[model samples]
Target: MKTTAAPGSPAGLLVLWTLTRTALLLCVLKVIVFPGPDVTSDVSVIYRGWYDVLSAGTFPQDDVTWQYPPAAALAILSPGLLPFLGYATAFFVLALVADLVTLALLLYAGRGPGRARRGAWVWVAGVPLLGPTVYARYDVMVTAVAVAALLAGVRHPRVMGALVGFGALLKVWPALLLVGVRRRGAWVSAVVTGAGVAVLFAVLMPGAFAFLTFQKDRGTEVESLGALVFHVARHHGWEGEVLLNYGSVEFLGPYVNWVSTGALFLTGAALVWLVVWRALARRLEPHTVADAAFVGVLLFTTTSRVISPQYMVWLVGLAAVCLCFRDSRMGAPVVLVLGACLVTVLEFPVWFAHVVASDALGVSLLVVRNGLLVAAAVLGGRRLWHATVPGWRGVAGVPGPAPAAETPVAP
Candidate 1:
């Protein structure tokens, strides 16, 4: 039997054409007409400071050292030569290009699905009222490498492992790629590449390795699990004390000390167990890597002590990859992430000015932003029901095309 789905009507096609033209025009206007003031902060400040350090022949920590791994500074300082865009604009455009690369990698990986899946990246670029595309951050470069690494994982597992190991040096999140990858050869490759990158890094800055070794001494954080406990304690007015419970160290907020390590360990254990479940069940599919990575990133953002806006760049780039998923159900997470980003842009750019001026309006936007992310999680989890292990997994003793945990999810 043959089924013929009707082609999109002329009217529908016309609407899409009109929207694309409007989006592109708006993008140009955004770039030319509204040359925004440099009001953004975080890695913007970090990157500029790094440039000064480089020009002065001093490593970052010697002056105003930020917490990122050393290789991240190389990425941050890359746009220095483009005087016209300023370090900021050049960095911004490069970030957008990186996102395009992520989109391409996603499309290439999912090409087996069909054209509609591949063409979805085009529609994603047209999603109107999206957040500002340019923000200064290393997330873009790392994300570009990370997405490329994911594609390479399927085609060139050894290279993928190497890329991820290097990317992990830039930002710790890339380490998660090791979970979904099952090959023993890839693991050895990752260890070898990571060691080589580490050796080069050592030569670059004689003391960097020592700094990294003591990296854990930096500080827990106000935004993290044990810190949150301290925050609630302070509000109620209690004596705060620090304790190491079963390997996890914690501190109370504001004071930065006095937390139960035991509680932290328990909480961490639960989260780690959940991650293992997601991995063991093959819940995070290769085609859904973009979606899963966003969830992983948000897990870091929402749970970690810092909520830097530039971090949004990482998730947004991955969102582009998820949108490239041919499955509509798989693509829903992209829509949620898109909404969250627009709110992120609105929240800042003026530092709570719009929010505090009209509290309800600001709160509404925040609610919408988090709500959409929550929805994306639901859609992504549902993918567990439909995902089928590839033939390659058969060699690894994983079943082929097994029935999903439930029915096919509507992406």
Candidate 2:
């Protein structure tokens, strides 16, 4: 983590930072070349494919099972113009941009190497899972907006809302933060900001409002854990299918159907309860809020079937926010950083290999990758929860709001 050492910052720090960044960029270039570019490790490739369709001036029209929300197809229309260059190349460029944006957002939001190492860990963990769901998906685009929104929230609420709203347009999950904002009138700010985005989307895309509104019509995405249903049913030799659906594992599942509905609702309800409890516990002083929000995003990813690799970028970026706050007890942020790296490696590279192979080994890899992330989210959330409140005071100076029974640490 880069530090603003008072009086005398490390003399070689800037040089080291520049060299490190240059090396990483070169490494990215090498990775792209060797793997023929991981189009599946990012949403850019998928966006590129859509761009091919969009340049023809036809909205996804639900013709080819346009998996993503409509806003994404609209946003990625321009990149299709580079017909001479392959989709993989454009995808790489976008992934690089997303990586750079994540890094820049970390720094701009006041994160240091501690968080950066966590990001590196996530990158490594995710490298294996980098195929189809990540490279060929648009998770990063919305993820970037979510990150930028969180970063902006500290200094600028309006800015935060726009980023959050844009992100929400790409995927509904980013809207979760609307409930996370606790400050008086902050809700109003978020509403205005989100509404402004809705209006702009309408002006620009002309029927985007309709796209945003009738979300019910979108079909269940088999890529989510719903795929597990198909897999399990196939194993039973029930080849004939009925119109069974399980929308995104988070929101629509419980309300739409019978089998997974109660389960999904319970899961989402539990998450909501946790969020509300944590927030009302009033542990969310600015720094703690950052930490908790990072945890929230992590929890969301793990519990939901949509474990897109680029979603890790959001966790890494928000972790950067928490790390910048002098929140950890170690005085050395490297502990969290290293854990994040380990988990990311377990998630990405390992899973990507599994997804590519499509064999037993690959399935196992996906299972373990998901397991590690769930563990990370649980442990990380516990840490953040306790960190938010010590024995006597919640944070350094903040008063406690949660009952003492909930505390795990002494002052």
Candidate 3:
């Protein structure tokens, strides 16, 4: 036996987590300034403003930037939990706590029979790659809830459903976590819980569902896959102007709406593919839910009209949960998502000015980052379909032996 600690030993992993998270906190706290734009301004300025409005007992109905679900107000108001600290400082502290909770959940899940600690390692490494932006946004807190929901999916599906419902209200993407769930209880619980939350918010808060109409006139965000069209067009006399619209930098004018519409069509096609996959799937393993969720989010994220840097946090969390199971075949997609995360940080806050200019550096970063996402979506979706659907290995135009009947795992 060696005297030195192994790389993934519990103590070593904790040490690494502590070091990286400490650096993240320092950057968010302004003790060490992160290069590029001030990522914390959202917390210090926008979130604080929202906090005041929420405390007044109504949503930010008039603000076009308030494009999130009603439950998102809770996240904005959460800094009130630590009144001794300033608003931004409290938000950062709570973000750190959420990050810690996510890590603990991954570590616990990784200790199960046939599970490995690679998922915990993934969480430890992936977050910091996006820099202080992780702490500046409420997305990390939402991710903690999503991580818990996925890890609890097999044994405690009702719990998973309830959490996913609450998480969806928080941001809306968490609803995709239910794509692979086969149990009736999970679906029933999700519907009841989501309805209850929506009704409660609607009754008590004015304009609770106003977020629905906020994106009607939204254009293609400069960071999205479709925005690459305009980035290239700008060089060849595409006259669209980049402007701060509806809380994100987007290309507006010319054929921007057409590109945005194309993105929506791609999203609809992804939904159709998922429906087909679900219908044909004949097997379900312990890791299958996580794998399907990872693939589902990948497809939607890559095809969306906006692929904000913080969106990587959601993918990282789902990817971590997938890796907790030794049987999960999402390894290649996980690596690609990690690569995208690294590129995301470079494109935003580091050399973000270059990206906005549609110059060589910014355009190159978008190409690499978005390219990685597209590749991951395709590969991960294919792997998920092959793993769950029987007869995937049959030769083209030649029939193969029937698949043996197998009992599906109880959800």
Candidate 4:
């Protein structure tokens, strides 16, 4: 197997990054911009609805598929403002912009005194490796906000909160970052600002709360880790059925709801563990908050009843941010995450039919992918825990934290 290029070797890192960037750029050119009906449908179809909402100044209350918060309306309408750009082109441009912004953040942050470029390496490599799904969905926008929030979490806690709050409006997952905030006032600021923005939109937008009811009726998504159990059971005469619902592949038969509930319960349990871990950590490194946030998101993503292919983008994004911290010691786990991203691409557009059929290839893909996610989560969680433990001894001869692991820079 090919080993990770050494972090100390700038030449090796450059070569790898260049190759990843080129490959990703080509993937975008061929897959996203030049996609067939299936791909365009994902992008243009959603764009049309958002454009209509913007032009008419109305929420998609009547549309069953519009399940996001009212703040999402702003995101949907954003690309429409691009001058002379068609909806699809504008959407693609917006996705590219988000990707570029994330890369810029990682690159700039890596240049700081104590930071490392490994996180940038992760972003450059992981995003493209995730395939065209990066542009097919709006997840990249939320990821950009997430990157900004994490980079600012220590130095400017309130700013971090505001960014995360705005991100949560676009997608609920970003709010999870609030749990990683260090200061009591800072955490409160993030919560209040995020909640305040959400409440403001709820009051002004018609369909702001519509998503809650809509989600209540959702079946377990076929791609979720929970669905893996059903996929295996399908071979042994399980009666569950799979179908495309609410824009995702989901299980719609007996016990599907039960599986979803179980997943939610597990997620809740994970959150509780995280809160306790943060409270009790003996030595909390500056990077601990970002690393903890990464672990929390990994738990949320892997355990949730929905694991869209694009979900990998969120996973890799946070993982990349965490790896930027020199002391994160996430090298092994991040490599696994990158490998998982590649497998996800194969499991998705390449062989999604097999996945739907629960065939050997599909099941195998899911197995490898989900297993990696589980491993990444476990390893990442463990590394974060050890890194934060107070008075922890360093490896052998090393006594203090590594130079790259110094306190985070103030913004």
Q: How much lDDT does each candidate structure score?
A: 0.52, 0.49, 0.91, 0.77
**Candidate 4 residue lDDT tens string, 77-157:** 877679698777677778777887888788777877668888887887788777677876888888999999888876888
For model 3, the stretches where C-alpha displacement exceeds 4 angstroms are 1-5, 393-407
Best-fitting candidate, measured by TM-score?
3
TM-scores of all candidate predictions against the true structure: 0.67, 0.66, 0.96, 0.88
Q: Which residue pairs collide in model 1, if any?
A: 223-305, 241-258, 242-258, 242-259, 245-261, 245-262, 328-411, 329-410, 329-411, 330-411
Models, CA RMSD each: 8.3, 7.3, 2.5, 4.6
Off by over 4 Å in 4: 1-37, 390-411
Per-residue lDDT over 207-261 for candidate 3, one digit per residue giving the tens place of the 0 to 100 score: 8998898989999999999999999999999877999999999999999889999
lDDT of 1 by residue, 212-317 (tens): 5433443443223334445445446656544432112334334453243443454465358437645554434444444445555545454444434456666665
Question: Compared to the true structure, candidate 1 yields what TM-score?
Answer: 0.67
Best by lDDT: 3
Candidate no. 2 TM-score: 0.66
Model 2 bad stretches (over 4 Å):
1-46, 52-58, 67-70, 78-91, 111-136, 203-263, 328-360, 387-411
Clashing pairs in 3: none
- List the candidate numbers ranked by lDDT, top first: 3, 4, 1, 2
What value does the lDDT take at residue 372 in candidate 2? 55
